[model samples]
Target: MRSKPLLRVRKTGALMVAAVIAFVCAVPLAGAMWQLTPVLLIPVVVFVWAWRAGTDVYADELRVRALVGSTRVPWQRVSELAPDAGGQISALLDNGNVIRLTGVTSDNLPRVLAAGGQQIGHSDQPPS
Candidate 1:
Protein backbone atom coordinates (compact mmCIF):
# COMPACT_ATOMS: atom_id res chain seq x y z
CA MET A 1 0.00 0.00 0.00
CA ARG A 2 1.13 3.52 -0.63
CA SER A 3 1.66 5.93 2.21
CA LYS A 4 -0.48 9.01 2.58
CA PRO A 5 0.83 12.18 0.95
CA LEU A 6 2.24 14.94 3.04
CA LEU A 7 0.33 17.39 0.85
CA ARG A 8 -2.05 17.05 -2.04
CA VAL A 9 -2.48 20.31 -3.92
CA ARG A 10 -5.40 20.44 -6.31
CA LYS A 11 -6.90 23.05 -8.60
CA THR A 12 -9.66 25.17 -7.18
CA GLY A 13 -13.07 23.48 -6.83
CA ALA A 14 -14.46 26.37 -8.84
CA LEU A 15 -13.10 24.72 -11.98
CA MET A 16 -15.42 21.79 -11.39
CA VAL A 17 -18.34 24.20 -11.14
CA ALA A 18 -17.27 25.88 -14.35
CA ALA A 19 -17.02 22.51 -16.06
CA VAL A 20 -20.59 21.68 -15.00
CA ILE A 21 -21.84 24.97 -16.36
CA ALA A 22 -20.03 24.42 -19.63
CA PHE A 23 -21.53 20.96 -19.93
CA VAL A 24 -25.00 22.31 -19.32
CA CYS A 25 -24.51 25.00 -21.94
CA ALA A 26 -23.15 22.52 -24.45
CA VAL A 27 -26.18 20.27 -24.05
CA PRO A 28 -28.22 22.40 -26.43
CA LEU A 29 -25.57 22.29 -29.14
CA ALA A 30 -25.09 18.57 -28.61
CA GLY A 31 -28.84 18.00 -28.81
CA ALA A 32 -29.08 19.82 -32.12
CA MET A 33 -27.38 16.97 -33.96
CA TRP A 34 -26.24 13.46 -33.20
CA GLN A 35 -22.93 14.32 -34.85
CA LEU A 36 -22.47 17.17 -32.41
CA THR A 37 -22.79 14.91 -29.39
CA PRO A 38 -19.04 14.66 -29.19
CA VAL A 39 -19.10 18.30 -28.10
CA LEU A 40 -20.16 17.03 -24.72
CA LEU A 41 -16.79 15.42 -24.31
CA ILE A 42 -15.11 18.77 -23.92
CA PRO A 43 -16.56 19.54 -20.53
CA VAL A 44 -16.24 15.95 -19.43
CA VAL A 45 -12.57 16.09 -20.22
CA VAL A 46 -12.16 19.34 -18.39
CA PHE A 47 -13.98 17.98 -15.36
CA VAL A 48 -11.84 14.90 -15.29
CA TRP A 49 -8.67 16.93 -15.69
CA ALA A 50 -9.68 19.23 -12.88
CA TRP A 51 -10.55 16.29 -10.72
CA ARG A 52 -7.38 14.29 -11.38
CA ALA A 53 -4.59 16.75 -12.08
CA GLY A 54 -2.53 17.99 -9.14
CA THR A 55 0.65 17.51 -7.16
CA ASP A 56 1.01 14.97 -4.38
CA VAL A 57 3.98 15.52 -2.11
CA TYR A 58 5.30 12.44 -0.36
CA ALA A 59 8.13 12.17 2.12
CA ASP A 60 10.47 10.75 -0.50
CA GLU A 61 9.12 12.15 -3.74
CA LEU A 62 6.82 14.59 -5.48
CA ARG A 63 4.20 13.16 -7.80
CA VAL A 64 2.92 15.58 -10.39
CA ARG A 65 -0.22 14.25 -12.00
CA ALA A 66 -1.84 15.30 -15.22
CA LEU A 67 -4.95 14.18 -17.08
CA VAL A 68 -3.05 11.40 -18.82
CA GLY A 69 0.18 10.81 -16.91
CA SER A 70 2.16 11.55 -13.77
CA THR A 71 5.81 12.29 -13.10
CA ARG A 72 7.57 11.36 -9.92
CA VAL A 73 10.53 13.42 -8.68
CA PRO A 74 12.54 12.25 -5.76
CA TRP A 75 13.24 14.93 -3.17
CA GLN A 76 16.97 14.50 -3.57
CA ARG A 77 16.67 15.48 -7.21
CA VAL A 78 15.11 18.85 -6.46
CA SER A 79 17.65 21.59 -6.18
CA GLU A 80 15.28 24.50 -5.63
CA LEU A 81 11.67 25.56 -5.65
CA ALA A 82 11.16 28.76 -7.59
CA PRO A 83 8.10 30.82 -8.40
CA ASP A 84 7.58 32.81 -11.55
CA ALA A 85 6.24 36.33 -11.79
CA GLY A 86 2.79 34.82 -12.17
CA GLY A 87 3.27 33.16 -8.77
CA GLN A 88 3.21 29.60 -10.07
CA ILE A 89 5.84 27.37 -8.47
CA SER A 90 8.25 25.01 -10.17
CA ALA A 91 10.96 22.73 -8.97
CA LEU A 92 14.42 23.14 -10.47
CA LEU A 93 16.14 19.78 -10.59
CA ASP A 94 19.73 18.89 -9.94
CA ASN A 95 20.20 18.08 -13.63
CA GLY A 96 18.73 21.49 -14.68
CA ASN A 97 15.24 20.40 -15.69
CA VAL A 98 12.28 22.36 -14.36
CA ILE A 99 8.91 20.89 -13.49
CA ARG A 100 5.96 23.09 -12.72
CA LEU A 101 4.16 22.11 -9.57
CA THR A 102 0.43 22.02 -10.27
CA GLY A 103 -1.78 24.15 -8.06
CA VAL A 104 1.15 25.41 -6.04
CA THR A 105 1.25 29.17 -5.72
CA SER A 106 3.72 31.53 -4.11
CA ASP A 107 1.25 32.18 -1.33
CA ASN A 108 1.07 28.54 -0.38
CA LEU A 109 4.73 27.63 -0.94
CA PRO A 110 5.61 27.98 2.73
CA ARG A 111 2.86 25.55 3.64
CA VAL A 112 4.10 23.09 1.05
CA LEU A 113 7.69 23.35 2.30
CA ALA A 114 6.51 22.84 5.84
CA ALA A 115 4.53 19.76 4.86
CA GLY A 116 7.61 18.36 3.18
CA GLY A 117 9.70 19.03 6.26
CA GLN A 118 11.74 21.63 4.41
CA GLN A 119 12.85 25.09 5.41
CA ILE A 120 12.11 28.46 3.82
CA GLY A 121 14.81 31.10 3.50
CA HIS A 122 14.74 34.48 1.80
CA SER A 123 17.46 36.84 0.73
CA ASP A 124 17.18 40.40 1.93
CA GLN A 125 18.72 41.76 -1.24
CA PRO A 126 17.28 41.43 -4.71
CA PRO A 127 18.95 39.01 -7.08
CA SER A 128 21.29 40.39 -9.71
Candidate 2:
Protein backbone atom coordinates (compact mmCIF):
# COMPACT_ATOMS: atom_id res chain seq x y z
CA MET A 1 0.00 0.00 0.00
CA ARG A 2 1.13 3.53 -0.70
CA SER A 3 1.79 5.73 2.31
CA LYS A 4 -0.32 8.86 2.42
CA PRO A 5 1.35 12.14 3.19
CA LEU A 6 0.77 14.29 6.24
CA LEU A 7 -2.14 16.71 6.14
CA ARG A 8 -1.97 20.08 7.88
CA VAL A 9 -4.90 22.31 8.68
CA ARG A 10 -4.25 25.80 9.96
CA LYS A 11 -6.31 28.96 10.22
CA THR A 12 -5.00 31.97 8.32
CA GLY A 13 -4.68 35.14 10.33
CA ALA A 14 -5.70 37.18 7.32
CA LEU A 15 -8.87 35.12 6.98
CA MET A 16 -9.71 35.67 10.63
CA VAL A 17 -9.18 39.39 10.21
CA ALA A 18 -11.37 39.41 7.15
CA ALA A 19 -14.09 37.55 9.02
CA VAL A 20 -13.97 40.09 11.83
CA ILE A 21 -14.25 42.93 9.38
CA ALA A 22 -17.12 41.27 7.59
CA PHE A 23 -18.93 40.66 10.84
CA VAL A 24 -18.53 44.28 11.87
CA CYS A 25 -19.71 45.50 8.51
CA ALA A 26 -22.71 43.21 8.59
CA VAL A 27 -23.82 44.36 12.02
CA PRO A 28 -25.97 47.15 10.67
CA LEU A 29 -27.75 44.68 8.42
CA ALA A 30 -28.28 42.14 11.18
CA GLY A 31 -31.92 43.07 11.64
CA ALA A 32 -34.73 42.43 9.17
CA MET A 33 -32.62 44.12 6.48
CA TRP A 34 -30.16 41.25 6.56
CA GLN A 35 -29.59 39.38 3.33
CA LEU A 36 -27.35 36.40 2.66
CA THR A 37 -25.79 38.09 -0.41
CA PRO A 38 -23.40 40.49 1.32
CA VAL A 39 -22.58 38.43 4.39
CA LEU A 40 -22.43 35.27 2.35
CA LEU A 41 -18.99 36.23 1.08
CA ILE A 42 -17.45 35.69 4.50
CA PRO A 43 -18.44 32.03 4.60
CA VAL A 44 -17.05 31.56 1.11
CA VAL A 45 -13.74 33.06 2.13
CA VAL A 46 -13.62 30.92 5.27
CA PHE A 47 -14.41 27.84 3.25
CA VAL A 48 -11.60 28.62 0.84
CA TRP A 49 -9.19 29.09 3.72
CA ALA A 50 -10.26 25.84 5.31
CA TRP A 51 -9.70 24.05 2.04
CA ARG A 52 -6.23 25.53 1.65
CA ALA A 53 -5.26 24.75 5.23
CA GLY A 54 -6.23 21.12 4.89
CA THR A 55 -3.74 20.47 2.08
CA ASP A 56 -1.76 17.24 1.91
CA VAL A 57 1.96 16.93 1.34
CA TYR A 58 3.05 13.43 0.40
CA ALA A 59 6.30 11.71 -0.42
CA ASP A 60 5.40 11.57 -4.08
CA GLU A 61 3.97 15.06 -4.46
CA LEU A 62 3.27 18.36 -2.76
CA ARG A 63 -0.13 19.95 -3.27
CA VAL A 64 -0.94 23.53 -2.38
CA ARG A 65 -3.79 25.91 -3.19
CA ALA A 66 -3.45 29.39 -1.86
CA LEU A 67 -3.89 33.07 -2.74
CA VAL A 68 -1.39 33.05 -5.56
CA GLY A 69 -2.39 29.79 -7.26
CA SER A 70 -2.38 26.03 -7.06
CA THR A 71 0.86 24.12 -7.55
CA ARG A 72 2.25 20.59 -7.33
CA VAL A 73 5.84 19.71 -6.52
CA PRO A 74 7.16 16.23 -7.01
CA TRP A 75 9.22 14.49 -4.34
CA GLN A 76 12.35 14.35 -6.45
CA ARG A 77 12.60 18.12 -6.32
CA VAL A 78 11.96 18.53 -2.62
CA SER A 79 15.12 19.40 -0.72
CA GLU A 80 14.16 20.18 2.86
CA LEU A 81 11.29 20.57 5.29
CA ALA A 82 11.60 22.76 8.36
CA PRO A 83 9.37 24.37 10.94
CA ASP A 84 9.54 27.94 12.16
CA ALA A 85 9.02 29.25 15.70
CA GLY A 86 5.86 30.98 14.57
CA GLY A 87 4.26 27.59 13.91
CA GLN A 88 4.61 27.45 10.15
CA ILE A 89 6.22 24.67 8.12
CA SER A 90 8.53 25.42 5.21
CA ALA A 91 9.20 23.05 2.40
CA LEU A 92 12.41 23.76 0.50
CA LEU A 93 12.89 22.59 -3.04
CA ASP A 94 16.09 21.73 -4.85
CA ASN A 95 15.12 24.41 -7.40
CA GLY A 96 15.14 27.02 -4.59
CA ASN A 97 11.38 27.12 -4.16
CA VAL A 98 9.96 27.45 -0.65
CA ILE A 99 6.36 26.75 0.23
CA ARG A 100 4.99 27.50 3.68
CA LEU A 101 2.58 25.14 5.38
CA THR A 102 0.46 27.44 7.51
CA GLY A 103 -1.37 25.02 9.73
CA VAL A 104 0.93 22.16 10.63
CA THR A 105 0.54 20.38 13.94
CA SER A 106 2.98 18.33 15.98
CA ASP A 107 0.95 15.23 15.34
CA ASN A 108 1.32 15.58 11.59
CA LEU A 109 5.00 16.48 11.71
CA PRO A 110 6.13 12.88 11.92
CA ARG A 111 4.27 11.86 8.79
CA VAL A 112 5.79 14.76 6.90
CA LEU A 113 9.26 13.78 8.00
CA ALA A 114 8.68 10.20 7.05
CA ALA A 115 7.37 11.16 3.64
CA GLY A 116 10.51 13.20 3.04
CA GLY A 117 12.68 10.21 3.92
CA GLN A 118 14.08 11.99 6.98
CA GLN A 119 14.74 10.42 10.35
CA ILE A 120 13.33 11.87 13.56
CA GLY A 121 16.71 12.59 15.18
CA HIS A 122 17.97 14.51 12.15
CA SER A 123 17.03 17.89 13.63
CA ASP A 124 18.04 19.52 16.89
CA GLN A 125 14.98 21.72 17.12
CA PRO A 126 11.94 20.35 15.25
CA PRO A 127 10.99 19.22 11.76
CA SER A 128 9.08 21.53 9.52
Candidate 3:
Protein backbone atom coordinates (compact mmCIF):
# COMPACT_ATOMS: atom_id res chain seq x y z
CA MET A 1 0.00 0.00 0.00
CA ARG A 2 1.15 3.53 -0.77
CA SER A 3 1.33 6.18 1.87
CA LYS A 4 -0.36 9.56 1.55
CA PRO A 5 1.64 12.25 -0.18
CA LEU A 6 3.23 14.86 2.03
CA LEU A 7 2.73 17.49 -0.67
CA ARG A 8 1.18 17.68 -4.08
CA VAL A 9 2.08 20.56 -6.38
CA ARG A 10 -0.29 21.04 -9.26
CA LYS A 11 -0.97 23.63 -11.92
CA THR A 12 -3.18 26.54 -10.97
CA GLY A 13 -6.93 26.08 -11.23
CA ALA A 14 -6.95 28.80 -13.89
CA LEU A 15 -5.96 26.14 -16.42
CA MET A 16 -9.26 24.41 -15.88
CA VAL A 17 -11.08 27.66 -16.62
CA ALA A 18 -9.07 28.08 -19.81
CA ALA A 19 -9.84 24.52 -20.85
CA VAL A 20 -13.55 25.14 -20.33
CA ILE A 21 -13.39 28.35 -22.36
CA ALA A 22 -11.51 26.63 -25.11
CA PHE A 23 -13.99 23.78 -25.24
CA VAL A 24 -16.89 26.24 -25.45
CA CYS A 25 -15.24 28.06 -28.34
CA ALA A 26 -14.32 24.82 -30.09
CA VAL A 27 -17.88 23.48 -29.98
CA PRO A 28 -19.09 25.97 -32.56
CA LEU A 29 -16.16 25.21 -34.83
CA ALA A 30 -16.69 21.48 -34.45
CA GLY A 31 -20.39 21.84 -35.18
CA ALA A 32 -19.70 23.84 -38.31
CA MET A 33 -18.02 20.91 -40.07
CA TRP A 34 -17.37 17.21 -39.64
CA GLN A 35 -13.72 17.58 -40.55
CA LEU A 36 -13.19 19.85 -37.52
CA THR A 37 -14.66 17.47 -34.99
CA PRO A 38 -11.20 16.45 -33.88
CA VAL A 39 -10.64 20.00 -32.68
CA LEU A 40 -12.77 19.13 -29.68
CA LEU A 41 -10.08 16.78 -28.48
CA ILE A 42 -7.65 19.63 -27.91
CA PRO A 43 -9.48 21.14 -24.97
CA VAL A 44 -10.31 17.74 -23.59
CA VAL A 45 -6.68 16.75 -23.65
CA VAL A 46 -5.63 20.02 -22.08
CA PHE A 47 -8.17 19.64 -19.34
CA VAL A 48 -7.02 16.13 -18.57
CA TRP A 49 -3.39 17.12 -18.61
CA ALA A 50 -3.99 20.02 -16.27
CA TRP A 51 -6.01 17.84 -13.96
CA ARG A 52 -3.46 15.03 -13.84
CA ALA A 53 -0.05 16.58 -14.18
CA GLY A 54 1.78 17.43 -10.93
CA THR A 55 4.51 16.53 -8.49
CA ASP A 56 3.82 14.39 -5.47
CA VAL A 57 6.28 14.57 -2.63
CA TYR A 58 6.48 11.69 -0.25
CA ALA A 59 8.65 11.16 2.81
CA ASP A 60 10.86 8.70 0.98
CA GLU A 61 10.37 9.52 -2.68
CA LEU A 62 9.13 11.96 -5.30
CA ARG A 63 6.55 11.22 -7.94
CA VAL A 64 6.47 13.47 -10.99
CA ARG A 65 3.49 12.95 -13.18
CA ALA A 66 2.73 14.07 -16.71
CA LEU A 67 -0.23 13.54 -18.99
CA VAL A 68 0.76 10.01 -19.95
CA GLY A 69 3.22 8.76 -17.38
CA SER A 70 4.89 9.28 -14.03
CA THR A 71 8.44 8.90 -12.74
CA ARG A 72 9.32 7.94 -9.22
CA VAL A 73 12.58 8.92 -7.63
CA PRO A 74 13.63 7.57 -4.30
CA TRP A 75 15.10 10.15 -1.95
CA GLN A 76 18.34 8.23 -1.83
CA ARG A 77 18.76 8.62 -5.59
CA VAL A 78 18.19 12.38 -5.65
CA SER A 79 21.44 14.30 -5.67
CA GLU A 80 19.96 17.78 -5.83
CA LEU A 81 16.88 19.86 -6.55
CA ALA A 82 17.66 22.62 -8.99
CA PRO A 83 15.76 25.54 -10.46
CA ASP A 84 16.06 26.72 -14.02
CA ALA A 85 16.11 30.23 -15.45
CA GLY A 86 12.33 30.02 -15.80
CA GLY A 87 12.07 29.06 -12.11
CA GLN A 88 10.89 25.53 -12.76
CA ILE A 89 12.35 22.95 -10.41
CA SER A 90 14.20 19.83 -11.54
CA ALA A 91 15.71 16.97 -9.68
CA LEU A 92 19.20 15.76 -10.45
CA LEU A 93 19.60 12.10 -9.76
CA ASP A 94 22.69 10.20 -8.75
CA ASN A 95 22.70 8.52 -12.14
CA GLY A 96 23.21 11.94 -13.77
CA ASN A 97 19.71 12.26 -15.19
CA VAL A 98 17.59 15.34 -14.63
CA ILE A 99 13.89 15.09 -14.16
CA ARG A 100 11.84 18.21 -14.48
CA LEU A 101 9.24 18.47 -11.76
CA THR A 102 5.91 19.03 -13.44
CA GLY A 103 4.47 21.63 -11.09
CA VAL A 104 7.20 22.45 -8.62
CA THR A 105 8.55 25.97 -8.78
CA SER A 106 11.41 27.90 -7.28
CA ASP A 107 9.13 29.82 -4.94
CA ASN A 108 7.71 26.63 -3.46
CA LEU A 109 10.91 24.55 -3.54
CA PRO A 110 11.53 25.03 0.15
CA ARG A 111 8.10 23.66 0.94
CA VAL A 112 8.70 20.62 -1.26
CA LEU A 113 12.00 19.99 0.43
CA ALA A 114 10.45 20.35 3.82
CA ALA A 115 7.69 17.95 2.91
CA GLY A 116 10.34 15.35 2.13
CA GLY A 117 11.94 16.03 5.51
CA GLN A 118 15.04 17.59 3.99
CA GLN A 119 16.85 20.16 6.02
CA ILE A 120 18.06 23.31 4.29
CA GLY A 121 21.65 24.24 4.88
CA HIS A 122 23.88 26.72 3.14
CA SER A 123 27.08 25.30 1.75
CA ASP A 124 28.87 28.59 2.30
CA GLN A 125 28.19 28.55 6.02
CA PRO A 126 30.82 27.14 8.28
CA PRO A 127 29.90 24.15 10.40
CA SER A 128 29.81 24.68 14.16
TM-score of each: 0.92, 0.59, 0.92
Q: Pick the candidate with the highest lDDT.
A: 3
- The window of 10 residues in a row where model 3 has the poorest summed lDDT is 119-128
Candidate 3 deviant stretches above 4 angstroms:
125-128
What's the TM for model 1?
A: 0.92
Q: How do the candidates rank by lDDT, highest first?
A: 3, 1, 2
The alpha-carbon lDDT assigned to residue 58 of candidate 3 equals 98
The local distance difference test score of each candidate is 0.92, 0.65, 0.93
Of 1 and 3, the candidate ranking higher by lDDT: 3
Backbone clash tally (model 2): 3
Q: How many backbone clashes can be found in candidate 1? A: 0
In candidate 3, position 66 carries an lDDT of 95
Cα RMSD for candidates in order:
1.7, 6.0, 2.7
